[model samples]
Every structure is written in C-alpha cells, then in structure tokens.
Target: MRIPLSDDNGHQYRDLNGNGVLDPYEDTRLSPEERTEDLLGRLSLAEKAGLMFQTVIEVGPDGDLVETAGRISKSPTSEVVTGKHLNHFNVHQIATARQAATWNNNLQELAETTPHGIPVTISTDPRHAFVDNAGVAFSAGPFSQWPEGLGLAALDDLDAVRRFADVARQEYVAVGIRAALHPQIDLATEPRWGRQAQTMGHDADRVSEFTAAYLEGFQGASLSSTSVACTTKHFPGGGPQKDGEDAHFPYGREQVYPGGMFDYHLKPFREAIARGTAAMMPYYGMPIDLTVGGEKIEEVGFGFSRQIVTGLLREELGYDGVVVTDWELVNDNHVGEQVLPARAWGVESLTPSQRLAKIIDAGCDQFGGEECTDLLVDLVENGEVSEARLDESVRRLLLVKFRLGLFDDPFVDVDAAERIVGRADFRRQGFEAQAESTTVLVNREATLPLASSIRVYSENVRPEQVSEWAQPVATPEQADVAVVRLLAPFEPRDDLFLEAWFHQGSLDFPPGLVHRLSRIAEHCPLVVVVTLDRPAILTPLVPFVSALVADYGSSDAAVLAALRGRIAPRGRLPIEIPRSMDAVRASRADVPGDTENPLFPVHFGLTI
Candidate 1:
C-alpha cells in the first residue's frame, strides 16, 4: 500500500511531490481552483505542454502496461506517461471488466511514480452501443449492450435516456473510466451523413431536450468523484457535410450550409453549454463560404478557426469549458497499410508545427488523438506559443482532475468492477430498451406480432436464438415466414484507413440487394428488418414486403422479441426514409425535414 502525509489540520493527503511534506497542490481541503493554481505554478513548461495532447493508449494482455507500441497507439504506455508526461488517454479493447480495472490501476500506479503524481483521466467512446467502429466507438465487450444513439432517440423518452446514461456512468466508474467521449449531439440533418448512427436524430428541439438529460446522466448533478465527465461533441455541428461525405478524408472536407440554417445546428449545443458539459470537441470539417451575423467566417477547420472556437463558442456563447480538437489535426497517421493524413482541411498547406500554433491561437484546450508534446514544448520555448496561453489551458485541465478527486484516489476495486459492470439488472434493462426501440415502418395485413408456432427462415440472425421464438428453417422456401435483417446501404470504398467502418455514400439499396430480396420475398410472406445506421431509401422493397421494420443496433434476441410480440415496437422514424437518391441529392445539407417526398416521414411508425 502507498503512504500519505498530513497537514496542520490533520487532513491526510498524498505526498505527490515526494518531498515528505504536504504541498498546497496535494491538499484535499483546498478548492479545485486553488489546487490548480498551486499545481500550475510548479509544473515545468514541458509538463504543462503534455496535458494538451489526449492520445490513445492500449493495455497489454492480462491487464499489464504496454511495453511496446501497438497498431493504434504510437508509443508504449510508460513512454507516454513517464517519459512524455501525458496523463489523459482514451483506452481501447479490454478483454474483461477485471482486466479494465487492473489496467487502470497499473496505469495510475505508474502515474503515481511520476514527478507530479497527477492521476490519469481515462476516456472512452460509446462502448455500450452495438456498432463497433474503431474510428468512432467500440463494441460493448464487458458492459451491458444498448441500442445506438438513434435508437435512444427513437424511444423519445427523456427518462429512458437519463437512465441509460446513469447506468453507463456506474459501469464506467467501476472500471476506473472517468470521462465519456460521447453524448454526440450532432443532429442527423444530412440523410447520407455516415456518422448518423451515433447522433440523436434530425430534429433540433428533441435533440436539445435529450442533450440536457444526457449531460445530467453522465456528469450527474455536477461533476463529482463518482460522476463521469462527458465531452459533448462535434461543436458548431458536423452533420451538414457537403454531398453527405465525412470530413475524415480530404475529399470530404467541406461542410456547407446551402439552406442557410447554420444557426439551427447550434441549438443542441446551446443546451449542452447550459447543462455544464465538462468538455467540447470541434469537428474536422471546414465551413465553406459561410457568413454568420454579417461577418464572413474563416474557411478553416473548426479546430483551427478562432471565429468558431474562441469567438463563437467562448466569447459569444460564454462557454468557459475546455475545448478539445477532433483527433490528429496536427500529425499524419500511418499504421501499416492504412495511411490517414492529418485533417488540417483548409490549412493543409501549413507544416505540423504551424498547425499546432494555429490550434493554440484558436483557443483550444487540448488536441485529441495526438502525442506531440515535444512539438508544443518547442513552440512555447521558441515563443511561437506563449507560456501564459499554455497556463490558461493547463489550469482548466488540472481543475477537472481535481474536481474528479483523482488527486484523492484514482484506484478502483477490481472485485467491485467485475460485480458492477454488466450486472444482471443492467443487461435486462438494455435488452428491453433494444426491443422497445424497434420501429415498425410498414406492416401490411397484420403481418407482425408473429405467432410462436410459425415456421421461420432466418437471415443475419442466430439460428439458436430464432429457435427460441419459432421453428427455424434452412431456407426461405422451406419456411412459412421469412425474416431477413439488412444493413442500410452505402457505397463501398477501401481507399481510406477508416472509411470501411464508416457506412457512408449513397442510401439507395444496391441493385443486387434488391434482386436478392425480391427472390426471398417470392418464397414466403417477407418480414424485413433494415438496420438504419443511415436513413435508407426503402421505396423498391415497400410493395413486396409483408412487414417492414427498422432497428438501430439491436441484438437478434431483442429484434425477435419485438417480432414475436413479447415486447412491442415503440420506436418511430428518427429520420425520414427518403423516396429516392435523387431527393437526397437535391436536399440542402444544413436543412432537416427537407426530403421532398420521403417514403416514411420522421416520427412515422405503425402499431400492431
């Protein structure tokens, strides 16, 4: 066990400085601001610079510290913490709940041995969701699995959203995870936007209300030791991509406002700001030819745009929280065959050092997915970036750690972690939520509420799970009813590293898919469940299918439960199902509910 020291008032504290005395920065009685001030005064320029980069770090097999570099993490865990002094990390890929807690303890033990003894603040993308996109979110490996963000929006229940968030917080805190890199409030205004599965939906008012509940759930009444600080993200909106392409790649860098509704996108963020979110992240997309409030906004990415970051978010909106940039805006990522260049967007011509200067000047507090503290230290030493400016960010960062009680104790009980994470009650609630969020778009002649005695032909569903509800047949021709699950269509691209993971491009079902489903429909009364990661064009299959349904990251059991009428499908269309791809092309990027003749409008659903 570790030893501690006591001050004059007999309040015990960690001897963080290792000088055998209680330092002002280590005092538990002092306010976070007071502790931050004392710590800021003591930190060297290099140490302060390290706090600005929140990078990825992987755990070793059996929950040990990673001694060597991995595919995603640039350096080993020890190098980043002890050598480079980076404390903030986004952890990925844990085998079990115990492993996660052990890894965190090992990491904090390492941090304790460092010069300042600053505890690491671990953050994660939405891990409870079913979609496992490495660039966006991970799978629910050891946590209770819930539907994606769109499913939560489909439920349209503020109480349910709050409950999910609160449960997620408990699971996260158990594993020593202190920050949530989510509650992604970006509205799905653009139908073909690839990242819509993680968004709340297309409506501004509903998204705003949910955003408040989400913040309350994660951060609790306020950010405390038990609470998980949420980084409500993609500021100034990332949904209005030009031609519906993502900003991760160079070709998709432009974010247009053709409908001139730029202000409309900021509605949810206004709620996030009002709810006191712990951090905010600017997106990679650069606004194109945009003028706001009679002034022309600069055509730089929001991460490097002072007009968006400092002027709009900080000064205009009066948001004083830590502003973090989207990942890897300053450095190129080259992992084996996969190569992703830095997302500098409009300022692509500038060097990495110059880009770093610009990000700081734009008033960002941290650089996401970056580990170039040496570059930042050099910038400050060269007078390109001021030490005073570094202090401004470091103060905010340290205060968060202090407020989280990381200074008091960063360790968690490994036993408690195993018990609390993915508890039986939590899993039951998640499965129920999944079933409740399944939207019945078209059910002709009372085709749904399937009888348990009916013969079933399953596609993209587990045979054993299907056997639980109805007789599972080998082929559609052998069954009385056919159940097929299809993912919303997207144009296939293998050029970019993370492009395959992002379900982008066209929403129209490919010609081959239509032909295949047509064949299956002929064999029996078809029951098609389309996973709506993006708003899909369902016009071709509308006439042929007996029952049409939509799901956002639900399990086979959950979907089957709804199909069997064990649970009712209460979800509605969070976004409209467009009539055709032509309608998608003609619609404005910034406008919601703009699809000309949608097959199914937003909030459209059928009950049995």
Candidate 2:
C-alpha cells in the first residue's frame, strides 16, 4: 500500500505556491500527507521542546521558578500541578484496586488537559510484590501479585515469564495502568546489590530471552487488543555497580568496568530491542567514569549521556523508539532526585529552554518526573525552541499510543480490574514461581527433605512453616532434619537509610543464634534458607550446614513452590556469591556498568 503523503513524510511541501524553504512551523492548510508539518509549523519553538519532559507521580504543579537564562530554578518554591501536558505520568504505590482506579482517574484528568489532548500514559514501577521500598511507592500495591524477578529467574522458563507479564498487564489494564516501567534486564553481576530482586534471572542469554518474552506479553501483536506499553529499562543494562548499589544516587552513579564487563552487559538489551520494545528508560548512572566514551564525569550516569543514548543506542543498536528519562523530578528519596535536568528547574547558567534543547538533542523523547506545561508554552511563544521538533516527538509518542491501542481502547475495565486485578490465579502464580525460584545451594549429606517425624530446634526459626516438608520438634535431639532460616545482618549507613529500607532498624538478632542453629544443623543435616532481599554474606554458615538456599523472598509463594520441586531451580545467582566478604572487597570495583562480570558471568545458572 502506498502511504499517503503527509507533513511527517515531507509530502506537505507540495504546494505550487509554497516557498522552497521549509518554514519552522507550517501554517498552511495541509493535505492528509501535510497535516503533521502544517500542525508542527503552527507551534512555536517552546511548544516543540516541552513534549519531551514528564512529571513524576505527584509533581504535577506550577510554581514561581526563578527564570535564569530562560529556565526555571527549582531552588525551593511552591508549585501546583496545573498542566495536562506530560510525556510520562508515574503513579507510584499501587495500594488497592480502588486506589489504582482513583489514581487512573487523576491521571486521565491530566491527560485531558494536554494541548492536543495527549493522554498521560500512566506508568508504574513493579507493583506485584513486597519490594520493601516505600519511597518508590509502587513496590507493593493493589495489583495482582506475582513473584519478583528473582523468582522468575529461578524457574528459568521463558514461557513462565511471558505468562507472568500477560497477567501483570491484565491487572494493570484493570486499574487503568497503560504502561509498565520495568523488566530491568540488567544482569546481576554484583551480589551485594540490594536491588537485584527486580531483574530477570542472572544470565545474559537467559535474561535476554525472558526479557523478550516478557515484552512480548506486554506489547502484544495487536495494539487494538489486550496490549500494554512497557519500558525496558536502565538501557545498556545497569547491573555492575560498585557495591551492587543502584546508580540512583551519587554514591552508586560511578560505573566502574575494570573487569571489562561492558560488552557482555549489552546482550539482554540486544534481545529486548529485537523483541520490539516500545520505550526505553535510561538509568541515572552514566559510564562517564569508564571507557564507554573514554572519560570520567564526577557524577551523572548514562541517563543524560548523549554519547550513550544517541551515538550508542540510536546509531549503534538501531533503536528508533522513544527514550524516557528516569524519575528525576520527584523529590522522593528512593529513586534518583537530583536527576531532573538543571534546565527543568530554570537554573541560571543554562536556561530552561536550553535544558529542554539539550535533553532533546541527547535523544530523550520525554522527561520523566515532571508535569510542567507553562514552561514549554512560554518558550514556544518566544520562538526559543521549534514546534517542528515537538511534532517529531509527538509523532513518536502517538505511535506508541497507537501500538498500545490506547487510541481505541483507553479506559481500563473498571469491572475487570475489580474482578481480576488481584485474583486467586495471580496469587497461585506467585506461589508457583516461589517454589521454582528457591535453590538448595548446599546439601552435602543429602539431609534435606527430612523424615516426617524428626526433632528440630532453632531460635527465630519458624518450625511450623516447614513442618510439611519435615517434622517439627522442640528439641534438636529428636529431629531428623533442622531447617534454619538465617536472617542476614547489616548496619545501616545512616538513620534515614534504615528507616527507608527496613521497617525496624533497632531490632537486633539474639546473640549466638547462629551457634544454636549450628548445633541443630550438626544434630541432623542442617538446611539453612536465607530469606534475604539482598545477599546477606552466608560464608559463616558454609561449614555448619549441609544445605543452603537464597530465597531473596520477594514472593513467599514462589519460594514455597521452589521448595516443593514443582518448578525447576534455574535462577543462577545474578551476582557472584563470594566465598567470603574479603573476596568481594578485594575484587576491582571499576567494572563497566553495562555488561556482566566475568567473575560470575551472565547465564551461569545451574540446574539440579
């Protein structure tokens, strides 16, 4: 079919009386082919650039931002979210079906207010499980729950990942969640990272495969049907941080690639791009400190790196999709905050107009963490930015909307969201994943799956939870097997840190708890399951127990399913579990942020 001529395709220049030179904003009556250009020509420069930025979930307001260099300075001012024009709208904290519904309505309110009525595509961080991060808000919400990424990793089943994504889309669609902001395919190369729970399991090939499958489900073949837009994130992969710390903060932004993990880090991304991912969300970290561009910046990860985004992702990988910034505008402590461009705040050196220009030139289609419209509107009237550019972005954004079938089916099924948003099937899926995700790392004497009647003793251990797998007992003398779940211990970096990551910081484990558990392990074959979100250094118990398991229990049901052997344990450790803490500390910290560590390279999953 010959495509009709349109302004977007340069067909609108066909006017016999038209000037040879293209106008910045065409005001002519455009044919169907010339409509895009004509519309774009009508926009002033400022309106063109504003389409590229977004407001965080709660930051949809306007305030008196001191205009320095034509930019708003967010030094500290009261702002009210009055604009409807936002590239992305993040609604964090998925509380309940009702809450999600309400949030959806609020987002629609903003969408309806856009200049062209550009619907605010409400996106969410993972909301299926207990991620334990309250500040990010979407960790545990009203959506139907699923096993976290680790659980999916354990199953090592791409089909399972796809099914899970389909289910998640259902829940999201139910509550008006049009876009999903995850599938962090970054390989887990650093074991100490407390945040690997959200990633697909630990192998480049495996992660890539599952990531593709997950995307397949999220972006179905037909946009006119059950499809949800998804953003494959932390582009180029964001796993190899210094201490497994996220690149969200200054401490975690330096991507050291001393081990040369950069090349390997790109596999999953390659796969994701091949699978037709609609959107890409770059992380806050940049490879400035590494050889990515053979340079070092004091801070700022790849999110703003024009080299990485335009030169690499666009030119190298051939990804012609929309690029959205991470949540930088939100003052939230969990996600990156200092991430918003200095332009968005109207800084003195680089005006807001300049910031918007740089972000667009850098290949960012939308500015996340923001919802400002006046700034862009004002700039357009002044002819600082071109309206044609805004039209370009609008075209891209509209394409995604078209792909998601939002133009035809925008509203979520209020009834379905109520019916199946948190249905039993989803819960069962979580349990199933849990069982498959868990791994029995050590079982020297074949002491696990203890006899029905066996004595067990352990402090802070739930003997009853495992009673079905083996016998529960008061004394260590009579138990046939002892299952002790070890809680990894660590000291918080500061008061605020503990308050944000953990529910209670002051609570201390009873002393000699390991010693007592060791006695139980010695009495019978000991099976130690470490219920940790992050790796809790388990070397101390290596010699004491016969078996060890790392559940990283974001989903207890998945853990339980893994224990039952209903699902295969395919989740290889995303990051290397050091034999000792000293090993990790001695290793080079300057690994590339994009690739995997050869130390425990990607796809090292072992099957039992």
Candidate 3:
C-alpha cells in the first residue's frame, strides 16, 4: 500500500479542491464513493490505526485532575504530539498563549505531514463563560468569552445561536478544533438534577427544537470551509434521572422512565439524526432497565450500549456518522463486543485499557476524551483487537474529518478566529439571550426594574458591586431591592460514581438559606438568581421576590443583561424548580425526573 508517512513526502493524499496549495479555502465535500476511496487511499495501516482514538487531554504541570490542572502529562499528550499522529484531542484548557501555540503547532505539524493531510479534530466542553466543567479546566486561558448553554438558550434567537456557534467554531478552528463536544441536548426534566441548565430546556419538544437549531448553528448550515462539526449528545435522551442527580455519580446513574410512559424520549435523537449532526455522545446515566433477549445490561452511558447505539441509532435511525462513549466511563476493551475492564484500578475496578477494548467492540467508533491512541495500537499489536476493527472506525472518523474539510485546510487563521469569536455583536447577543431567557417567576408587587437609585445586597455579590446600579447599603432596610446569586451545590466525582452509597447523593447546599433570603425579600422587592448546576427548591422565596431568574451556569452576562433589559427575558425554565425539599424527597427517587409531583410543571416561568 502506498503509505503517507511524513507530511511533505506523501503521494497517498491528492489535493481535492484542485488547488495547487493546501490553504484554508479548500473544499472537501466528496461523493460518498469518492470520499470513501480518498480517505482509505490516504491512510496506511499505521495511520488508520492512529485515527481510531479521540483521546482526553491533560492540563498543567500536574497531570492529575486531583492536583493542579492546566498541564499536559509527560505520557501521551507529550508523546502523541511528538510522533505526529492523532485523530482527536479534547483540550483541558489552553492555559497560556504559549501553551495554545504549542498545542496548535503540534497539530499543524502533523497536518503538514501527509498527501491529503488531515487536520487534528480537536474539541472542548463549554469555554465561553462561567462554570467551566469537564470542558475547559482553568479559569485563565486563551478563550473566547460568551455565555453558557442556558444563557444561549435564554437568548432564544436563531441568529444568536448561530453567532455563538460561529464564534466557538472560529475560536476552536483557529486552535485546530474541528469538532465541538457539546450542545448537550438532554431535556432537564427534574429541577434538582445536576447539569440541568446545560440543556436548552425541560420540555423534550423545546429541547428538540433548540438542539436542531443549535446543530445548524454550531456546524453551520453545511460542512463548508469555515463551519465546525457539531457533536449532539447523550443519545436517546439523558434527563429524567431518579433523583435529578447526574449518572456520573453512583447515586444518580440509574435511568428510570416509569413504565415507559415517556417512550417518546428519544424524540430529540431522531431529530438530531434527521438534522445531520456530525457526532453523538451517550450519557453516563442513561441505561434501559430492561434488556434485549433476557440479559441484565449495566453500563454508565448509552453510547456503550448496543441496544442504544447499534439497535436504535444506527439500525433504526439510519445515522451513518460517528458514535463515541462518554469520557471516564467507557474503559472496557472488548473482544468481538465482549467488554473487559480497565488497567488503572486505583481503588477502582477497571483500567482504561480494558474499557477501551470493550467499547470499540460494542460499536463505538471513537473514544471521546481519551488521551492515548498508543493504547489502541498496543491492543491491535498484541492480538487482543483486530486491524479491521481499527480500520472500520478510522474510515468513519476520516469521513467526518474529510467532511469538516480538515483534509485540505487544517491550519487556523488566528486573526480571523479572533475577529469572528467573542465579537461585540455576539456578546451583545448573549446579553439579549440572557434577558429573554430570564423569567420573572413572580411580579405580585410589581417591584421589578427597580429604579437606578435602589440599593441591593447579595450573598455572593458585594454591596459595592451594585454601586453602579444604586448606592451601597448596610442592611435590607436601606436597600430597595435585595438581589441574591446562589450557587448550585456539588461535589465533583467520577463519571460512574462507584463509591459508597451515602457519598453518592445529590449536591447539598446550605440549609434554610433561601428562607433567610426570603425574609429579606418579603420586606423588600428582591430578585433571586440561582447560580447553580441543578434546580433549587424555590417555594420559600416565591413570596419574597418580584422577579427571579435561574442564571444557568453562573452566566454573569446573562444575569446582567436580563436585569438591564438589553434583551427581553424569554427563556422558559429548563427544569421544574421545586417548591420544597420535602416535596423533592417524597417524589419517586427510583425515577428522579420521571416523577410528576414537580413543584412547578415543565416550562414554568413567570415574567414582569
């Protein structure tokens, strides 16, 4: 086979756009047959092996998540970047301009190697605004600033979503990112469920609507020179947990549908498929309690399930794109779909190696958030995995990479990226989104739009911080409005949550604090904005505030915009905010979000 080993000396690659040079404007759309032949012909066995993995990235000097973040480990990112062959990388965070440059330079060098040289498919979690989680790790980095998904959802404008996705794509492509790891489209059915705001809203219908629109925005209307591919996530619907907790934690891993009454949950995935999403990610918690043919199936995410991915998505939905398992969960390496546990058992049972094998065999084409392609190569060499399997995945991956036009123009125009990303127009759009998304919840006293002369006090916000709006105040008596920013409680844990039962509970926040704030709100017209990861019980504060906004993911811009009326508030609540803790506890824990005793129904929002 004619192999393309080095960047400059490979004939296996042919320039597609008929351009004499490999420039940013090259077009890579191929007829299905032509695309297959090109991708196959360009990759040698070794190179194809390299394309199977979509690995995790390390941050900082300390490679461990437990220690300091923002550094790459000496092992793979250092090693993989050196050998110059990788399919995908999910950056932890680009800490410095130097780090960003180095990472880009590595991918750039790799792209410069082959005939139809493919650009590295880099991706990231949310990086625009506040509450950076499994996506970007560091607070300070070379990032394009914007609002979170909820903030974007609040904007409820197709133009704004398009702008946000465009900027994100520009920022990513500039730094060699071709794939976007999110637009987590799961419906936030349960309010107290962690990661609720990450979605567009609670209704499957709304979530479906927003996700379809977002997929278009993020990926662009088509896979052209400038558009980045959107990876729509948590297939077959991920929300409706037993306790509104994430499945990443053990206590929240069980997915309950309540006798399959909500059988239409997969409505969004069907839409995503119809909309031509570039990729799919199975969530950690979503597992069908029943089994096909009478075997108890247990796995964290749906991507790892054949019943979910192969049977439903590929066979029924006719989706011919890539399917990758959620990070940290798919560790078992499989032998003809027979999954085995992992190698790194640090008080844990499985290592990533074993898990990797199983997931590949189980029909997962790519490994999301993995850092080591070498591991897959090793397995292939050791006779544990097959070359055909690797080839299968590589072909699918390369197809998308080709579709992304990475094969032609891999290098990012940093200047263009800067110009397009985080532009004043986009930021203004985010502000508008926040305002529209923010629902007042209550306006009995009509205390909203407090005069510029009114004072405010908050737990997280200082008196001086509100000085721009009004004078500093010492007590609730002195303030005309008491604005509070509350944080969602959490204890970051592993994706599977294979820990003790007690430790596997939903995030805990301070008790009776909302009530205390309510007392202050009762006296004065107050606006409470919950800066949280999950839904908070708000019955206590209902009587106190004239306006309320669940500032999803601590989007300060969204919060500010809503209050300032830069954009009209229109975002319906993504989850039903409960009335009390007892109500939540009394609801079915077996089927967390599937329960109907919500303090507030889905899309419950009040406006001034």
The local lDDT score (0 to 100) that residue 257 gets in candidate 3 is 62
Cα deviation of 464 in candidate 2 (Å)? 6.1
Candidate 1 lDDT tens digits, 1-608:
34355465677778887887778898888899999999999999888988999999998888899988898999988999988999999998878999999999999989988889989999999999788877899889999999999999999999999999999999999999999898898888899999899899989999999999999989987889989999988999999999889999998899999999999999999999999999999999999989988999999999999999999999999999899889999989988898998999989899999999999999999999999999999998998999999999999999899999998999999999999999999999999999999999888889898998789998899999988767999998899999999999988888778888888888888889888988989989999999998998999999899999999999999999998889898998888888999999999999998989889999888887
Off by more than 4 A, model 1: 1-9
Query: Please, what is the whole-model Cα lDDT of each candidate in the order they appear?
Result: 0.91, 0.58, 0.60
By TM-score, rank the candidates, best first: 1, 3, 2
Per-residue accuracy of model 2 over 472-527 as CA lDDT, tens digit each: 57766776665556555544654333234632211123448667777776677777
Instruction: Encode model 3's per-residue lDDT on 1-608: one tens digit a residue.
Output: 11222232342334433336533223233353366555576556557666666665554432222122223322344345435365577766665434454456555554555444556777777666655454322221355555566656655566777766666666666656677777787766555566655666655666677777777777766676676787777776777677666565544667766545344567777888888888888776655464534555554456556666777678867988888767655443332333323311221354566667767766788765455666777888898999877777777777776666666556554555555545566556545554566665665656565567666665566545467667767778777777778765545444332222112234345557756876787567777776645666566566556776666543554565566555546665555665566666666433324434655555666654
Q: Give me the displacement of residue 593 in model 1, in angstroms.
A: 1.3
* Ten residues in sequence with the least summed lDDT for candidate 2: 63-72
Tell me how many clashing residue pairs each candidate has: 0, 66, 43
Ranking 1 against 3 by lDDT, winner: 1
Candidate with maximal lDDT? 1
Per-model RMSD to reference: 1.1, 8.4, 6.4
